[model samples]
Target: MLSWPDELTTELRHDLFGWCELWSVPTLADEVTVAVSRRLTSSLGRANYRHQRVTLQHTLLHPMAAALLREVLCHELAHLAAYRLHGTKIRPHGREWKALLIAAQYPPNVTYAAESLPACFAVHKRFRRPPARRSSWARLTQWIAGIPCAVR
Candidate 1:
């Protein structure tokens, strides 16, 4: 039942929008859903391509550093970005993903040392990462902008 502060969600959304703009992709800002979950057992964050959602591990929020959270957020979002640009058949950490990470100003490291955090957060959970089709924050935002201002 852990949840993120509204301000944190705002910041994350802003970052996602910025990345979308950087890539010149179509967007509907509100479409890139962010969910908090305590169910994650091995990863701090995950991106679901089918639903255009990013799930953050709830337990990690309290004890994990903001920088770490930001990094993980960007990492998970990059997966979505890469998927949007490439088909689902592409490799998870393939060239397209690396390119997107570089463009997004992320370190492009496939694996992170989740052990740095305290035991309060289960940083070792194995979350699923899906390959993507063409849908992203940019496209979501653009689509939303065309309609009325919606937040969902």
Candidate 2:
């Protein structure tokens, strides 16, 4: 099986592969490429179904708790599972993806609580904003944040 960098343990890999097998996904357990990405910030993980690739924040696995790792890992992997079963035209975190998560026994939350990981906390700090901002600006920010990642 292809190893996920930064020590995503062998057991965890087996579990993920098993999930793929159980779901009968097009992506094989050994065929999926999981890598540690320096570019991932504010996000715990990302999936590119077209490339059959998953890029996780490197820090997320450095001494990370297994539960947190599984949560994030399952979350990202479900995207590929969903795409394999459905199609790319579907929303990134829409019903199809959520259903995959449910079947996989993972919470369907799209965003993770990064404060749990030290490295992710550092990334969060880099993007932290002041406590106060203009109301209009805050409203605009909320509106923009609501836009889908695939569209952005």
Candidate 3:
């Protein structure tokens, strides 16, 4: 029972270890590491079996998204679980992985619904266009016409 980092709540740790135990791979917990990635904008989570690490999107850390966070965590953990149990020959989202997710009580869906994401983690809102800066050509034309440059 290694103490996980602050990002992993006690409940999450319990679920993670419990899954590993259920799969008869109790030592898997020690082999895996979980991390939060602010750079992960396009995806909710990623699992790297080669490195035995799971990287979750930073937004999932928000308390408002706790349920989603757990699901994504379980999703990634299932990847690791399948790899450990089945080796490299299995498809990434094949029956084995789906079964693991089902066994863990999560839907075996390959991807989450975008609308289900918390608004704070919306991609469009996070990277909003910076006030539509006037191009240099627009500014030059406005200067020649003695007109004030307005951002469009």
Candidate 4:
């Protein structure tokens, strides 16, 4: 079974609280939950609005991925935030989520740029941006499902 590092969990909770405060949803902080998943092969993180939980891919725990960890976590958390604020009717990455990302100072991009990521971050294989790239049809399906264009 996979588990989260105690220190990292604590830090993430602190960040979660900070985000809630920033978004003026302090009570939502306590309602939020975090989990780590080794089974997440393609995505970096996921948010379940109905459950108020954020699950992170274990790779974000890697030392080299430190810089991206917060961004990805907040990205998922923003989904929860949007849902908490707007109900289930909003688009996953639509204006509301994009506004939250902007408020958090992250680009509203759906996926991280391969060239800008750390080399060991597994941009190609894990994010599904193979050297040759995937078929346009594949990209469209993933996008329609709210998956990142490059990451599942």
Candidate 4: where is the Cα deviation over 4 Å?
1-9, 111-152
Estimate the Cα RMSD of every predicted model relative to the unseen true structure.
Answer: 15.0, 9.8, 13.5, 9.3
Q: Which residue pairs in candidate 2 have backbone atoms (N, alpha carbon, C) closer than 3 angstroms, thus clashing?
A: none
Backbone clash numbers for all candidates listed: 17, 0, 0, 0
Quote each prediction's TM-score: 0.64, 0.67, 0.70, 0.69
Clash count, predicted structure 1: 17
Per-candidate Cα lDDT values, in order, are: 0.54, 0.60, 0.65, 0.63
TM-score of 3: 0.70
Q: Rank the candidates by TM-score, best first.
A: 3, 4, 2, 1
Model 2 lDDT tens row, 1-152: 56576477878887888788777874556667888765565455667666777777654554524565576677777777877788777776778877877788765654422222222212234333324454533522332244233211
Clashes of 3: 0
lDDT of 3 at 133: 77
Write the residue-wise lDDT of candidate 1 on 60-145 in tens digits: 35532466566656666666777777767676666786787788776665543223221121222222321245233332223223
Give candidate 2's whole-model lDDT. Answer: 0.60
Cα lDDT of model 4 by residue, 82-149, tens digit: 77788767777778877887888877776533232111112234335422465534432343244434
- Identify the candidate with maximal lDDT: 3
Best-performing candidate as measured by TM-score: 3
